[model samples]
Target: MIYFDNAATTKISENVLEEMMPYLKENYGNASSIYSLGQKSRAAIENSRIKIAEILKIKPSEIYFTSSGSESDNWAIKDILNKKEKNHIISSRIEHPAVLNSLKYVESKGIDVTLLSVDEFGNVNLDELKNSINDKTGLISIMFANNEIGTVEPVYEISKIARENNILFHTDAVQAIGNVKFNLKDLDVDMMSISGHKLGAPKGIGILYIKDGTEINSFIHGGSQERDRRASTENVASIVGIARAISDASENIDENIEYTKDLRDYFLEKLLNVDGIILNGPIENRLPGNINISLKGVKPQTMVRYLDMFDICVSQGSACAAGSIEPSYVLSAIGRSEELALSMIRISLNHNNTKEECDFVFDKILRGMKKFKK
Candidate 1:
């Protein structure tokens, strides 16, 4: 099967799984236990933390592992309440549901929220963000990159704005972890969230980077794990898996970017040859492996099913929001009509994808367009 849904989740690397097997079987123990088996698990967890921290150029103490990126996003956004002085938050309209829904939850609790608008290409307007900031605006949570459109936000500039205004900044970097090149230290964002499954690890592990001195309230209570910040029994195997997966992804990122960009461009070029095919997101500054487009006369779900018939996997939009009857909010935010939004499909590539596969997908897509177009 040709898997074009890497943005939703990636196949776990064999090397990562090999490393995790020991913890899953022989070394299975609670990290919080006082025994040696538990200590082994505890040691593995810390070692993974250190490796991930070194990769982002931050202290290991600052990294906290949670269940998933959604949990991380929720924790960071909810932490705003801890700062009673800061009653307002600024985010964009194109954020993943994790952020948008969490904002809605906070809004229910009397916290003011201002959703900044994005351009047609899904780039958050820096001018609008600057104009929206006020003393009451205590937090600015924008994604590092959009999941559906693959638009890389001006996060460095946004972080700088937040710092200047003495407001905390948080970025959900789930989709940006391996695809985009940036040093977290230099970016200087106060909080960032990453998920393991997006980068080749299992789905049960995630990390929230809380910079030193960024005080936030605990997310999960009843335990002393994660330096007492996040509470849970550690998933030792998945933690180790994430460390290995991220290490490999980070080390070979440059090569991976070049390879995926080549495949993406080749596939996109071929797809654009079809009449009435519209590309979403900016041609420049987008993720190397993401290709989103709307086939003017076709429904996205129908196209997805058509592709699946040939064992080729694609998606309509975010997997988290799959099956919703409403059109893509991301596409709509970028000024797509309701019909165009419903026509959108996302083709996310990875290092494992090849030119031959792209060719096959393109051919199938053309056939699908002909078959399904209204």
Candidate 2:
């Protein structure tokens, strides 16, 4: 299968799986226990945390593990809202559903939320962000990079405004972890969220980074874990898997960027010229592996099914909301009409995807496009 839905999830690398094997076998033990077996698991989890922290240039204590990016996102927003009696927060209209839904739930509780509008390229207007801040605003959460359209936000500037105003900043970096390279230590953001599955690690593992002394409440009440920030038995194996994947990805980060960018550009150069194809997002500023397009006059779901018949995997939008009859809210937020939004599809690349795979998938998509020609 030519899997172009990598923004949904990636194939776990053998190295990551290899790192997980020991914990899944004889090393299995609760990290909270005091016995030697448990100590081993605890050590592994802490080591992985330190490794991930080192990669991001943050302190080990700042890293909190969760089941998924959604969990991290929900926890961060909820914790912040519940901690202080603050009633206002800010986020982009183009955020992942994880953030959007969490805000929706809290909005019912009398808290104020401002979903800032993005430009046609899916980038949040920094001026709007600056204008939105008020004394009641406790936090500002915006994604570092968009999943559907792949537009990287100017988060450094956002962080600056948040910091200057004494408002906390959080970014959901789920799709930016391995695909985009940056030093988190340099950014003034208070928190960031990452999902292991989006890169090379297995599912059911994610990370949240909270800067030192960031005022946040705990949503989970259980045994002491994650420095008393998150409460749950650690998934030791998945922790090691995610840590190793990040480490490996960082080692060849430049190569990954160059290779995937070349393939994505090549693919778009060929595909965009086709009649009725309209490119989404800012082509120059988008993620190297992301290619979103709208086939004017074709239903995205129809094209998705047609491409799948050839074993080429792509998607209409996020896997989290796939198959929903509603038009893509991300597309709509970026000014796409309902019909144009419904006709949009995403083609996310991966580190391992090759030119040959692109060529093969291109022909299949060409045939599918013709078959659905208006």
Candidate 3:
């Protein structure tokens, strides 16, 4: 199958699974135990933490593991409000459901939330963000990159604004880790979230990076795991897999960017030449591998299912919310008509995708769109 729905999830690399094998088998000791075998598990978890921290140039103590990026987002956003006296929060309209729902929960409790609008290119209006900040604004939570359109945000500059105002800044970098090159050492953002599955690790593991001195209350209130920040027995195997995935993705980040970008450009070049196709997001400032388009008369679900018959997998934005009838909020936020939004499909690539796969998809797309027109 020519899988192109990477933004939804990825196949775990063989090396990552191999790294986790021992943990799943003989090394299946409790990470919290005092026995030598347990200590071995603990050591492995810490080592993974250190490796991931080093990749982002952050302290190991700052990286806290959670079940998923959604959990991490809930923890960071809610914890900031919990620890602060302010009742106001700021975020963009294009955030994932994790952030949007978390904000909604808080709003129900009387906290005011200001959602900044994005321009036609799916970029957050910076001036609106600056103007919305007041003494009561406790935090500004924005995504480092959009999941659907793959529009990279001005996180560094936004972090600077947050820093100047003494407000916490958090970014959901789940999709940005391997897609773009960024160093936490150079960025002044106070918090960020990442998921292992997005980087070729297995599911059920992710990291929440809270910079030193950033006040955050605990999310899960049970065990003292994750430095008392999160609770639950650690997934030892998945944690090991995360280390391998991070190392591999970080090392080849530059090469992957060039390869995926080339494939993406080639795919788009062929796709744009088709009749009655609308490109979504900023053509110039978009993600390296993300290509979102609207097939004017074709419903996204219908078209993707058609492609699925040909073993060409694609998506309609977040996999978490894929089956819903509602149009993509990311597209709607950027002022797309409902007809276009319902017809939009996200074609996301990865390092493993190839030019041949791109050509095959292009040919299938031409056929599919022609059939739809007929």
Instruction: Give the number of the best model, judged by lDDT.
Output: 1
The best candidate by TM-score is: 1
Residue range 1-374, candidate 2, lDDT tens digits = 88999999999999999899999999999989999999999999999989988998999988899999999899888765574566799999999999999999888777799999999999899999999988889889999999999999999999999989998899999988888889788986898999999888999999888899987777788977988878889999999999999999899899999899999999999998898888988988889999999888888888999988888899899898899989989998988888778888899997789989889988887887888867
lDDT of each: 0.93, 0.90, 0.90
Candidate 1 minimal-lDDT segment of 10 residues: 78-87
TM-score for each model: 0.99, 0.98, 0.98
Query: Could you tell me which 10 consecutive residues in candidate 2 have the lowest summed lDDT?
Result: 78-87
Q: In model 2, where do residues sit more than 4 Å from their true spots?
A: 83-85
Clashing pairs in 2: none
Query: What is the lDDT for 335 in model 3?
Result: 98
Query: Clash pairs of candidate 3?
Result: none
Please report, as a residue range, the 10-residue window in candidate 3 with the lowest summed lDDT. Answer: 78-87
Can you write out model 3's per-residue Cα lDDT over 1-374, one digit (the tens) per residue? 99999999999999999999999999999999999989989999999999988998989999898888999899888865574468799999999999999999988877889999999888999899999999899989999999989999999889999988999899999999889898899997888989999989998898889999988888888999988878899999999998899899889999999999988998899899888788999988778999999999987787899899999999976787899899999889999999988889999998899989998888888888888853
